[model samples]
Target: MKILGLIVEYNPFHNGHLYHLEKSIKETNATHTIAIMSGNFLQRGEPALFDKYTRAYAAVKNGVDLVIELPTMFACQSAEIFSHGAIATLNSLNCVDSICFGSEEGDVNILKTISEILVDEPNEFKIYLKKYLDDGMLFPTARSLALFDYINKYNLLDISKEKLLDILNSSNNILGLEYIKSILKLKSNIKPYTITRVQSQYNSETIESNICSATAIRKQLKDFTNIDSISSVVPCNTFNTLKDKINNNFDPMFDDNYFEILSSIIVRDINILNTYFEVNEGIENKIYQSIFTSSSLDDLKESIKSKRYTMTKVKRTLNNILLGITKYDMNNIKNIDSIPYIRILAFNDKGREIIKNIKNNSDVNIINKFSNISFSKDDKIFKTLIDYDIKASNIYNLIYYKNNRNLLKGPMDFYISPKYVK
Candidate 1:
């Protein structure tokens, strides 16, 4: 069985995602597919429009065979950390044959060439990178400029500096590069492929066609756009699910909902902020000061973001603070392979078959029921990772209370189970 793996954040699986899934399976000639998706919080440091299980169910219904979650600790971080965790999760499965991703630059060779340079960090590349960082440029920008300079100085490839910078700048291409970098770092055998994104751009906020970006879908939903407006963009199942949710008065949520709690946490203890991941270089002071003037999440982000700190970086830092994800916690899982267990979210018959194959190849615990974690390899670090996911789920579930005052109380993860799709 050739199992194809995909790393995704199917916030609400749309037509573009469906096309990628179908096209990837055909291109790889795979018999089964596994998708490593983000939990409630996404890489951009925002809560998902819907819960993890809802998104995973849509993916399985649309075509994916299995959907396992990328743990919360790794899910809501920078591109490197996010890709490292996802690639490592797929590697741990021990049954996946190839991993495919959608990218603006669909050439795997080009992406791999850049990944090699990043992973190796040649002497000259290091010199250039250090120079840019010393000049006070943000890391991503500095790295991009450094790569451009190093490649041109050495004549590594026939590509122009402009073209190379373009590759590094495109969001999807940047992620694709990280995916290949992680693969090389681990020396994993899973082959990587790229499917060129078509139609809408990655962060486009307007629907150009039936395959608009998820950002556009979320934007419309945030404005309370009729579900019919997004009908043509998402799958039938997704549309129905979203429609039912809207009809029941459960609106799509965003980071704004947690603003008050986040502000309270920031003002409650300024000293504790430095302990969280990415809350360094005096950013905690800026965050603490911003809360006094900021009225919303976006306001606080704008107040803190600067040339050295990009908007995405600021957002991720705020989320880390709110979730109480500390630098110490991240240090323990520096080696991606240490991501203990596979947390299954949704699956089908083919997915079950893949699980059976996985059990034959690796000793990693496969958990579908939250309580099963107690019986699995018990350790402080392992329990800490699971606790973060549970905390995130409980917080995410809080939004539903606004619509249904009678919803279940307490943590949601304990009562939830992996969705089984026939």
Candidate 2:
């Protein structure tokens, strides 16, 4: 009855993801699986190719026993926040025995060791981190260099600074480290496991094999919109589902889909952007300035991104503004350790049993339907979190009708029920 948990976006549930899922189950020797997935938005601050319910249905159809939604407030955030939300949710599910993630390094020991050092932040490590920051390096770059130096100077691990830097810089490894950190911070009993990422790099945009990156699949969909273009890279369920959607004239969303709405909001009241999350260091002015000259989302990002702010960070900040996630909102729940409720998206018979197990073992609120949320009367953060998820979905619905903007599909979360697979 061991339940394995996976933190994922799935996007379209490609072959690489399928490989990871099978290998994770095999490695963990688990009987059941639960996936805490992102909703309409993703960690990269981009809209998903398909809506949450569609993606969750695909995951359940493939292998995952249960799928839970990661709140939008954390879904479209930095590595730390995203990992915290995911790990906390899994930890709350007391029946989960272990969690698995794909990483370039593929060694839980090394990732765990690094997470320990980060959580402790020994005096020497702080000195090195401060030195890099004082030299004007970006926080991520600075932190990586600091870790490289701290580890080497202390002879913590036998790895070289070059190799260490490579590990720290890799996208999957970074997320893996953060996952480990969250587990340690929460003092959770859930064990951690990692598998080596295969076939393609995280940011690769070209498909060369059956196991290419999600980025490549999305790029193909954006350019061709033909299911055949991505058929080889994704599973049958993904291919057939996408084909059905395409056949019905449904469009896959991309980051640029929200560019017009985002740009308009920024131009309409640039000062208002200052109130949003991560809209610091006068970035609002840069975004406002760039809006007049920039044509597309990518162009606007390129205009505003600098040594102080990486492109990914800038994108997240801009999307946060568009979603109206204020710094105040985040500040309000900084100390709250776990997600307020578990929002189930999809499940099967095995998943139903796991839900029963959760009900008997943990006190965490389980949201089977939107109406169930009313039980949390005294929990302000619960309302805030659910509101953001609903807001993000409504906003995504707004941009989804790019072809016929007048025919806006209103409020999906309230009407859409959790997908139950046989």
**Clashes per prediction?**
0, 0
lDDT of each: 0.89, 0.89
> For model 2, how does the per-residue alpha-carbon lDDT over 66-175 read when each residue is reduced to its tens digit?
99999998899999899999999998877889999999998888898899999999999999999999999989789988888888887878987788888888899999
TM-scores of the models, in the order given: 0.94, 0.95
For model 2, give the RMSD to the true fold: 2.1
Which residue pairs in candidate 1 have backbone atoms (N, alpha carbon, C) closer than 3 angstroms, thus clashing? Answer: none
Q: Assess candidate 1 and give its lDDT.
A: 0.89
